[model samples]
Target: MESHILAISGGGFSVEEKAFIDEYLLKIPRKQEPLKIGFIATASNDAQGYIDEFYTAFKTEQPSHLTSKDFEALNIQEVVNALDIVYVGGGNTQYMLEIWQKTRFDIVLKNAYQNGVILAGISAGAMCWFETCYSENEEEYEEFKGLGILKGSLCPHYNDEQRRIAFDNWATTQKNNILYTLEDNENLHFKNEKVVAKIRT
Candidate 1:
C-alpha cells in the first residue's frame, strides 16, 4: 500500500474539463473498472450543486459509486478505506479545515493514503495536501496551515485570480516555506508521498 494523491487545480466538477479529468483518472492506477470514487465536499458543506457537478464530470466513467464522504456518516473509516479513489471538492478553505479537524478526517485521510487509496481534489482540496496553502481565505490570498502530506505550499487558480499579479511578491515575502502555484488545468500527482510527474495544462 502506497500513497497516490492528485491535486487538481481547476474544472473540478464542471463539464468543460471532463476530457482532461477522464483521461487523468483513467490513467491512474486502479484495481478495476468503474472505480469507486468518494467525493469529500465538506468544504462546500455537502452542497448539492457541487455534488451534481462532481457526478456530471465523471458520468461517462460510470463509477462503482460516487458518494459525499464528508457529509458525516457511520463507519467513516471503513467507508473511506474501501474506496479506490477519493475526490475532494473546493469551497471555503478555512471552514473546511475546521470541520475536517473536528471530525478527525485529517487523520483518516493520512491513513487512507498509507493504505494505497488514491486521493484527489481541486482548489481548497488541492491546497490542503501540502505543508501549507496560500489561500484567498479573506479576499486577498494569504498562507495557511495544511495537511502536509506533500511538502511546502500550493496556490490554486494561479492565472485566474485577480490578485495573482502579486504572486511573486507574496511568495517572496512569505516568512517561510516554498509555494507551488497551479493554473486552472495544471495537476499535481504523487506516489508514495513523492511526485511522479506534474501534468501541466
Candidate 2:
C-alpha cells in the first residue's frame, strides 16, 4: 500500500484562498462515492468555528469532525479505518501532539496511513507529519520532534522571516538531512516518504 501525505504550509480550508489545492486533496482518495473524510481539529483545541468552516467547505462530502471527546467515546481505530482521508487543522502543534499521544490516536493514525489513508493538513497540521518541524510557541519559533512518518524537517510559514531564520539555524545543525521550507501558498505531496510533487496555489 502506498502512503500519501499532502502537507500545505498554508491556504487550505481555513483560508479558502486556494480551492484547487483542496480539490487536489479531495481527489487523492480512489473512493468516488461516499468518500469519507475526517477532520481533526485537535491543533485548534477542537474549535467549533474551525469545525464549522470545514463542514461548510466540504458539505457535499459530509466530512466528520474528530474531537477530543470522540477520542474517549469512540473506537479510534474503527473511526480511522472508516475514513479515506484525515485532514488536520492548524493551531498549537505541541498541544495537539500531546493529546494525540495521550489518546493513542497517533498510533491509530499511523496504522491508518499504512492502510492507504490520505493524510493531509496545513500549518501546524502540515508540520506534524515530519521527523522534526519548526513551530511557533508563545511568539518564539523553535524546533520540535514530529510523528516521524515523513523523513526530515518541515518548516511551515517560511514566508515569515523569523521562522525562516530559526529554521535556517536549525538546518545548519541537521546537515545532510532533507529540509522542506514552505511558504503560505506552497505545498508538498509525498508518497511513500518521497516528495512526488511541489504545488503552489
Candidate 3:
C-alpha cells in the first residue's frame, strides 16, 4: 500500500491547495479502504472544476467521467487497474501530451504508480509528471518530454505572470534533474519514491 503524490498549481484552486489536500489525505495508510479515486483531468476541463472542489476537501471519491474528455474514452489498462487515487488536472501541456499519448495514458500511468497507485498532478498536470518539461511557450525556454513519473524538471505555472519569467529561467539551467517550482499553494510529496513532504501554501 504505497501511494502518495500531490502536485497542485493551476489557473486556480488554492486555500493552501485545499489545506494540502487535507494534509495529504492524512498521510494515507489507513487500511487502504474503499478509496478508489482517479481523476486524471487529462489537462484542464477546468480540471473537472478542481475535481469537484476535491469533494469539499478530501476523503476521496471521484469517478463519474471526470473530464480529460472522459480520459479520451478510457481503457488505459482499465484506467490504471481501477485506480486508487490518480488526480491529474491542470491544462494544455501540448494538449496534455496530446491526449496523454492518445490514450496510452503513459503506460497505464507508470504501471499504476509502480503497482501501488496514488499519483497526483496539476498545472499541465504537474508538468506532465516530470522527466523534463520547461516549455515556457517559446521565446527561448524549452525542454519538453515527460511522464517519467517524477525524477526532475517540472515548473508549473509558478507565480503566474506567464510563468514568472519561466520559473526564473528554469532556476538557471545547467539541469540535471530535481527542479520543482509549483508555488500558488505549494506542494511536493512522494512516498516510496522518496521526498516525504514539503507542502507550503
Candidate 4:
C-alpha cells in the first residue's frame, strides 16, 4: 500500500499542515498500517534534534534514522519494507548530493518512495529534490541539476535574497519554475505533482 508524500520548508511544522496530513490519510485508497518514518538529515549536525522537534511538533513517533555514510550498509530491502514516510532534512545541497550519490543513498530513497514511502524535505532537502535548482554563487546565476523528484526547478529564499530582481528575471525565463522566500514559518504543500495549497503562519 503506497502512501502520500509531503515536503515542507524548515522552521517548524505548520498546524494547518498537520491537519492536512490527517485529511490526506483519510483519502489514501488503502488502509494505512502503523506509520513508520525514516528520517534523513544529512544537512544538519544535530539531525536527531531536528527529527525530535518534528516528532514533538506533530505528536507522532517511529523508529530509526535512514541516515549516515554507511546508510547503504543497512539492507534497504528490509529497512524500507515497513516504512511509510521518509523525511529528509535540509543541509548544503552540493554536499548532501555528494554523500547521497557516494553511498547510493539516493537510490535507497527512490526505492523507499517507489515502495510507497512518502518523501519530504526542507531547505537544501527541498531544493535538491526538484529537477533543477537556481544556485546562487558570489555573483551571477547557475542552474544545477537536482534529484528530479519534482519536474521544475526550485529557488529557496527567493524574496529574501538581495538579488531578488535578478533571480526573478531568471525564473521568468524558465518554462517550469517556482520561487519561494518563506518567512520563519511559511510553506507550500503539493499533491498530485501540483501545489495544492500554501500555509503562512
Candidate 5:
C-alpha cells in the first residue's frame, strides 16, 4: 500500500472545493469500487452543525460519527479499513487530539495511512497531519503536536488567520521552523511524506 495525505487550508466549504476534494480521493489508486469516505468531526467534538455542513457541502446525507454509537463502541481501525478516504472537520486541535488519543484513533489513523487510505482535512483537520500546526483558537494562541503523517509544521487559513490580533510576527518571528502555510482554496498534496508541488491546486 502507498501513503498519501492532503492537508487543506480551511475556509467556508464550497462546491468547487468539494469537487476538487472528491476528485483527489477518486484519483487515488484503490482496488475497491464505490469508495467509502468517512468524516471525522472530533475537532468540533462531532458537532452536529459541522457534520450537517460537511454533508451539505459534499452534497450528501449525514453519516454516523460518535452520535449513533458509544464512543467506546467505535472500532477505529475497523471503521478506517472499511473506508477509502477520511475527511476531518476543523475545530480545536488540542481537544481533538486528546479525544483521538483516548479513543486510540491516533494509532488507527496512522494505520489507515499505511493502508493507503487517503487522509485529508482542513484547518484543524489539515494541521493534524504535521508535527505542529496553527489553529483558530480563541482567547490565546497555542502550539500543537500533529500526527506526523507528513513532514513539517502546518499553518492553515494563513490569509484569514493573519487578521487575528494574535498572529503577530508570523512571517519573521518563527525561525528554524519547518512550517507550510496555505490560504483558502489552496491545497498541499503529499506522497510518502514528501510534498509534490506539481500536483498542488
Candidate 6:
C-alpha cells in the first residue's frame, strides 16, 4: 500500500476561506461511501473548539476525535485501523511531539500510514511528518526533528513575512536536504515518500 500525506502550510477548518482544502482532503480517501475520518488535536492540547469545528466541517462523513485521553482507554492500533483518513490540527509542534511520544501514538500513526491511511494537516500538523521542521519558539523560529516519515525539511506558513525570512535564512545554512515550502493556500501531496503533486486551493 502506498502512503499518502498532504501537508498544508496554513488554513483549513479554522478558516472559512480554506474550506476547499478540507474538501480536497475528503476526496483523497479511497472509500467514498461512509468515509471514516479521525482528528488528532494533540497539537492544540485537544482544544474543544477545534474539535467542534472539525465535527462541524466533516459532518458528512463519520468523523471522530482522538485525543491524549483516548490513549488511556482505547487500543490505539484498533482506533487508527478503523479510519481511512487522519487529520491533525496545528498548534505547538514540540509539545505535541512530546505527548505523542509518551503515549506512543506516533508509532500507531506510522503503522496506519503504512497501511494506506491518508495523513493530512496544516502548520505544525504538517511539519510533524517531515524529517525536520521549522517551528516557532517564543519570538523566534528553530529547527526541530520530526517523525521522518518524509525526507528533507518542511517550512510551513511560507507566506508569512517572519516565517519566510526565518526559513530563508535557515535554508542558507543547510547544504543538503530539499526544503519544501508551502503558502497559506498551498499544499504538497506526497505518495510513497515522494512528492506527487502540488495543490493550491
User: Residue 191 lDDT in model 6?
Assistant: 86
The Cα RMSD of model 4 versus the native structure comes to: 4.2
Per-model TM-score versus the true fold? 0.86, 0.95, 0.31, 0.73, 0.80, 0.95
lDDT of 3 by residue, 1-201 (tens): 675666666433333454545446445645455566656555554444566665555544444335544555546567666767776666567667766788666777787777877777667766777777776443555677887777877676577777777667666764466877766667677786567876665
Q: Give candidate 1's TM-score.
A: 0.86
Q: lDDT, candidate 6, residue 79? A: 81
Ranking by lDDT: 2, 6, 1, 5, 3, 4
Say which candidate scores most in lDDT.
Answer: 2
Query: For candidate 6, lDDT tens digit of each residue in 1-201?
Result: 777999987778888833878878777775649789899999998999999999888888899988898866567798897788999999999888888888888888999898888999888889999888777866668788899899988887888888888889989988998889888878998988999889888
Model 1 lDDT, full chain set: 0.75
- lDDT at position 147, candidate 6: 90
For model 5, residues 45-130, the per-residue Cα lDDT tens digits are 77888777666665542233443233456575787766777788787888888788777778888988888788878778888988
lDDT tens digits, residues 44-68, model 1? 8788787777777777654433334
> Which pairs clash in model 6?
none
lDDT of 1 at 54: 70
Each model's number of backbone clashes? 0, 0, 1, 0, 0, 0
Question: Which residue runs does candidate 4 get wrong by more than 4 Å?
Answer: 1-3, 13-34, 45-48, 51-59, 136-142, 163-166, 172-185
Instruction: For model 1, state the Cα shift of residue 177 in Å.
Output: 2.2
lDDT per residue as tens, model 4, 1-99: 533445555453423345443334324434444466566778674366676665664455454566575476767666765666666677667667777
Q: Whose TM-score is higher: candidate 2's or candidate 5's?
A: 2
lDDT of all the models against the reference? 0.75, 0.87, 0.64, 0.61, 0.68, 0.86
Candidate 6 Cα errors over 4 Å, as ranges? none
**Residue 90, candidate 5: alpha-carbon lDDT:** 80
